[model samples]
Target chain A: MIKQFPIQQFLDENGKILNKDIRSQITTELVKNFYQHCVRIRTFDRKAISLQRQGRIGTYAPFEGQEAAQVGSALALQQDDWLFPTYRDHGAAMTFGHSLRNILLFWNGRNEGCIPPEGKKIFPPAIPIATQIPHAAGAAYAEKRKGTKNAAIVYFGDGATSEGDFHEGINFASVMKAPVVLFNQNNGYAISVPINKQMSSQTIAQKALAYDIPGVRIDGNDIFVVYFETLKALERARQGQGPTLIEAVTWRYGAHTTADDPSKYRDQTESQQRRHTMDPLLRIEHFMKNEGMYDEHWINEIEEAAQAEIDLAVQEMEEFPVANPADIFDHVFAEPTWGIQKQKEEYLRLLEVNP
Target chain B: MMNTVIQTKTLTLVQAINEAMDTMLKENEQVILLGEDIGKNGGVFRATDGLQEKYGEDRVLDTPLSEAGFVGAAIGMAVNGFRPVVEIQFLGFIYPAYEQIMTHASRLRMRTMGYYTVPMVIRAPYGAGVRAPEIHCDSTEAIFTHMPGIKVVCPSNPYDAKGLLIAAIEDPDPVLFLEPMRSYRSVRDEVPDGKYIVEIGKGNRLIEGEDVTLISWGAMVPVALKAAEQMKVRGIHCDVLDLRTLYPLDHELIAESVQKTGRTVIVHEAHATGGVGNDIVSIINDTSFLFQKAPVERVTGFDTPVPYFGFEDHYLPTPKRVVHAIEKVMKY
Candidate 1:
């Protein structure tokens, strides 16, 4: 049966709740928090792009259009759960307690960017596509073995579905009943290749069926759907049911990274139209206004706070010590191999000669 | 009677591996064994036999045939505080998991700047001469030796296998533990019981001589020894060093041996082009240049894919080849 996975939603684009059951759970404070986080990460993402263009940082992967999927799913994880993010998922990482300074430093090409805060089981953003899928599964299996209540969530893109790791991770996790959630953002393109050109499979969620697990399709632009669905999936994991694959149908409104232009492959006007109709931030704003929870003064305060926070993080990142070339050799092993030591010395000699 | 008490036990290479894993599982709660058919099937070669029953399914996992998944998963488990020993069934089959091993597992420590260190072991049965067919007999330990973070290890005998596997598990870095499939059943030696470690970067000198140095590892070790024995009969005393760990290299041991002998012959079953032999030759050229009485010679397989069964004998390095290499080196 090739029945379509109905695109599940909890709020319309205009901000009215489509589900009555969630109305009680939705509070003004929760709405305010969601708006603030969305704005905060959006601010971080835009500032990062500007930094890249100004040569302040390395190439940046922006998530301006995928904030709800990042923030909502991150908000669903428990304090002790594991989060495995990709190069494009730092918005999710920040929402999950990752340091803004460290995230900035990561884009600056420092190894210090990979370190997670104490007690936060956040893996470094995997640059290799789909590699973190199995890692998240494995981490979840460790928690299950320890008989802990912890779970894991792995974030990937639409293109990652075509990777061998996606199947391997999902299949293994399914067979082992690992306590993990496979969260996929269907952002439509991998660098330049569209999803249709990449894989024949119509939906990322449908691939989960092959592994015999629950597959969900949600409006990633709608915060409530993303948050509630991820929580439901995670609850299944902690109860030993197994992993759930969530296909967050979303879009990226900018270039894949600061180095490329989106207009080369797709029409700019189409993107602008999509942004007006499907932007996650605008969708939330619509909902806040509909619920009469939207306060202009409070909203102004949030934008200002986000700007100040991002500015401080930029300062902190810039003030960090310059990356020592020796740390690269030193940390290659727990103890440097003799070969590494010799290479380090040779490098130093070469530098001295050049200088 | 007390003086006559038997302590050392003779076991095969596979038996030594099983016992070492059993000991680790018993001693440390974090040690886990995972691979295809390792659980109910006790592994394709029975190296992990009865471990699933003894340690339970939680510790001994029977993974699917996906190498990338399980290997990457093992890296994660290691990062999350579990010491996972993963098996790739065959060394040839490990290619599918190479990205996980090379890009992620090897770089985790360096990329995280030591905030995260991967403490894991990837066990693969390598080398040829057992006639196991194509895609099953790869002796490419040199590939891993080229990597910076991973410790490349190969044990030629039961004693070394057990000790090296323990050391590999205890090591804070990722280790590529290559087992000699040819010696798995053929080579039996007296192995000590309980926990022991053969340090990852030290070379073992099997025999000492003043004439020439014979360096080898894995299945080539016995061939080197036999050649040395033959040289001894011809009154050409030779020193032999088994390079247990190839990457960090026992450069000191290799240098000392080459210095004393003033000549050297490196033997291996892998193709000659970019093998570990070249690295050793360069080191000898650098350190023992003044001590050399003859040019270095290498007895290695041809620079080609390992041929199928009938031509396999000609494809692998032989004691004859090693002896020939020694003769050629001495003549130089």
Candidate 2:
């Protein structure tokens, strides 16, 4: 049953374009867009991990090896579409026009980090697994009812499939014909619990059969495949044909989060070997070289520009306004209830007396 | 009631809720009704009776029996410019969606720093009486009250039901609207027609007196009122307070009433352990402790799960128990 959804790929391990049909469709501008975003997000992820190590930011979730999956799916979204990302999907959010400073602020343990830029339809990173699935469905349903072409894309890990909300959200979307794409990035493990330990199902894509939605599996390391498949899914959603489940099988070369230790559960050597054979960035660079579009200085300029932008974001994040303790009581509701007001007043009085 | 000639109708608590939802649905195009059996079936309690037919399937949705799914989806709809009112068949059945409520719906506003507000309501018929089976009559509003972001509103009568439901639907945050199952059709009041808000976070003093302060809400409000009537006959005037909103309990009313009486008896059907009544005691201690002439007494259900209907009467707080607590506080 799992073999029914064989891993689809446009670029193989050697960066050869296997799909001749999409050859002409892949323009120089399109490949460059993918390449730039992948590099930019990868730079952001690595800098974030380093910040965490330096105690400049709190624990960070890195998408080092999964850059292609995040960049591809995020680039496929329209400007008006909604994006529901998990805590690890900040890379995707950054790719979708979320502010890099705010993303860094979030890692720095500031509430202001949660706020998306003005008019951006990106939701705060959902910390809980699978809970955002139904939220995305509901958002898509709302857009569908309003007679808009806008759709929603929700990203989750492979372990999220075992949750009841995942099934419920997909079932509801299927029944309602909601314009949503359940983007599953199967990164092999949920912390230390590998995919097989979490579910008996061989493939996350196969779970779509239960909800009666079209499910496809793709090589997540291949940026071309991830981009086109997500675009196809989004197009289907916009056409009112209902949701499609796309499983981008990928790997994370780092710990689940800064607090986790991947070395304790999985072989570190395997992750090191995957970098050479199936790195998302290496695959893209391989394709660029094979297409004779790999300019060494141009690529160096992209890397340098990405680093400079990330450094500025880090500085801005550090210089962000100091958090006011009163804000804890203020945002609990639109207007503070009496109890909250009284508590805040008493605390403020205490602060004044003590200070 | 509005001063202008707004029509009034005698309605049961359930009917008042139906009217409230009807009014909101009619007035606001963004008001959406979704829950299991809510559309054609009009809800298990018929609180949403005839709404689907009047509105369309899109407006009044009959959702799958996934509490977490629908509630979470409602939160999404709420953030996306829709005011969703979700009905959980019973309060006990809401545990499946408790994570969504606690982690998402309640915290979304604070988590997003006010960029998004979940203006949604979760209406669950709670409390024991009328012989509901296990887990069907749980009155566990305390679990929600402990959380800060969500407002917990419970109305004891039809008038407050309609007004508070309207207020909750209009409020710019998530509200857990608890409707006592026992009071659903057992009591009737002249519910004012048209739109009105009873005001969240305010307590209503039903029967004012100079004696003991009787604090209660939801199904227990009737029990407290009955006990107050008995005390009145015994030459002890009582102050009966219905705390419409549990999260932000009416501090001023409670302080004023407790200060005047110098004695208090908090009544509720939920378990005595960690119940809202304990919060009332804390409020009295905080604001009116110097005025207190006696230790506060609490009349509540035993710290046990609500029993089956056959044994439910013994498990619920009664007027007799409340009277005993009142007498104990008075004597103390």
Candidate 3:
């Protein structure tokens, strides 16, 4: 018989702890780190939206209300574990050591932006919905066969679960016992189609039941729950216990992208209400106040520091040399095919003749 | 190493593929096999038979029936520095994994601007003529050739299959190696033992003539050669060029053959409309059109889905059709 899976939360919307056992786990240093990273990413998200508005960057997808879900799960990863992110998961990528400058360049349509820094197993943002699901499964399986304890974590939205790749990835990982965490952020909209219209299922977490793996539903606005639960799922993977599906129940306050307008489909009043009631950063600030650790001086310092870091990355991305047009022809293959060679030569000849 | 003598062995096309995988797996620890029924069952076509028993389960994985999942995972493994060779049971079944192959695996190098290279090989039994039921007999490789940043290759015999599969796995790019269903056992030859590299993006000029250049790959190579043999009886000599790699087509070879012959007749099993033959004709027209003696003709399948066995032979490009096209081009 199918049963209801309750959403788990350590901190409620009013900065109250529903789980008493988590009280001792909340350290001053931990909360401070969460607050700082949260502010940093939020600032970056806002700046990206502004850049797109000014034509400084191409279309941008903002993660304004999904900071905790990104930061917490990313923080839970070991250095060697792989991370597969989607177009909207750059906040998670940045937290996991992707360069801010590269992130900016990616929005500007440069290929350099797609690359992760050396030794970081972060994948390029999968533009196709749920395509990374199987890729993450395969990479994690590779680690298992090599006798390594390394695992992988992949991120997608509620909309991606509808794609065939979602079920395929889940089924394979379940059967092979691959070490992977399928992190799903139920953001309620897939380019204006709400979750209610997309699927008849009550929850994305329930889809994991058909595959027979652990499915978890959590309050993504509560960083403590997101962090601890992801850590547990990853541990199960490292222990060879197989994969886990985490459905992070969250919301998106901004439009899907700079090119979209949310006002057409949904009411702005509800979003304004959620900002005060369920904002992840505000929840943490409230917790710090209750614990007597809230400081205006520290908050201002983090704010100024986040602004400075974003400013430097913006400058670096803009100042980088323009990509060569010939680069488009090269690297199609390790050795360019004769056809590619001919096309490249023909293209250049046309330019020369015209000039 | 270059001075060392190469040993040769006689085997079927499928056997040659197994041998190539065996040698590669034994040679490199990083190489692994993943596919449905690929482990204990050896593969649906037996192309990867016995590799699992020899290499063990860790290296030779029998994956669940999820083409998109497994193929995408192979790409993931590729980016993480593992050389994964994936086997899709049938070419028609590749629709499920097309998103992975086209959107991600093919574009990974170009999108990342060379920071990431997917060093993997995807092998599938493609083409028709063995009377396979449905979906399994699509010879339409144009779907893959149409995409850039991916090397599309089809080996016509045991020797080239072995060498090309090896080269595909080792190369720092994703390669689609199509093993025609008809050639599994029907086509056999003296395949060399030990390692050999049949360079990708090059055409093999199987036979030489001056009347017309007959161009094809995969299953149709046999048809082209047969037609060439028949044409020779009428003193209509023709040059037969096997395009081993379709995407990075050996235009140089096509150009030279077309220039000398001053005529061309392209044959393939796919529909004539969007077939890679059309691409070849376009390339020849662009490069060797001025030297052309007659309009290029194409002996290709009808612009329709591969029909049932009732009309299969009629649908396929027969040697008679190739001869007709050759005769028509020559008379012009």
Which digits, one per residue and each the tens of the lDDT, describe model 3 over residues B83-147? 99999999889888888989989999988878777998999998878878977788768999998
For B301-324, candidate 2 gives per-residue lDDT tens digits of 899888888888898889999999
Indicate the residue-level lDDT of A324 in model 1.
Answer: 79
Number of the predicted model whose TM-score against the real structure is largest: 2
Greater DockQ among 1 and 2 belongs to: 1
TM-score of 1: 0.98
lDDT of 3 by residue, A1-355 (tens): 1248788899988778888987888889999988899999999999999999899999999989999999999999999999999999999999999999999999999988988898898889989899999889888987887789999999999999999899888888888899999999998899899998999988888887898898999989899999999999999999998999999999999999998999999998989999999999999999889989899999999999999999999999999998776888886877777768778999888888994
Q: DockQ of each model against the real complex?
A: 0.87, 0.81, 0.77
User: Native-contact recovery for every candidate?
Assistant: 0.83, 0.70, 0.80
Regions of candidate 3 where Cα sits further than 4 Å from its true position: A1-3, A349-355, B1-6
Cα lDDT tens digits, model 1, B1-332, are 76854467899998899888998999999999999999988888889999999999999999989999999899889988899999989999999899999899999999888888889999999988988989798888888888768989998899999999999999998999999988898888998878888888898999989899999999899999999999999999989899998878899999999989999999999999999999999999989999999989988999989888778999999999888888898888
Q: What 10-residue stretch in candidate 2 chain B is worst by lDDT?
A: B1-10
- Off-target runs (Cα >4 Å) in candidate 1 are A1-3, A349-355, B1-6
Best by lDDT: 2
C-alpha lDDT score of every prediction, in listed order: 0.91, 0.92, 0.91
Most DockQ-accurate candidate: 1
Candidate 2 has a DockQ of: 0.81
By TM-score, is 1 or 2 better? 2
Displacement of residue A245 (Cα, Å) in model 1 is 0.2
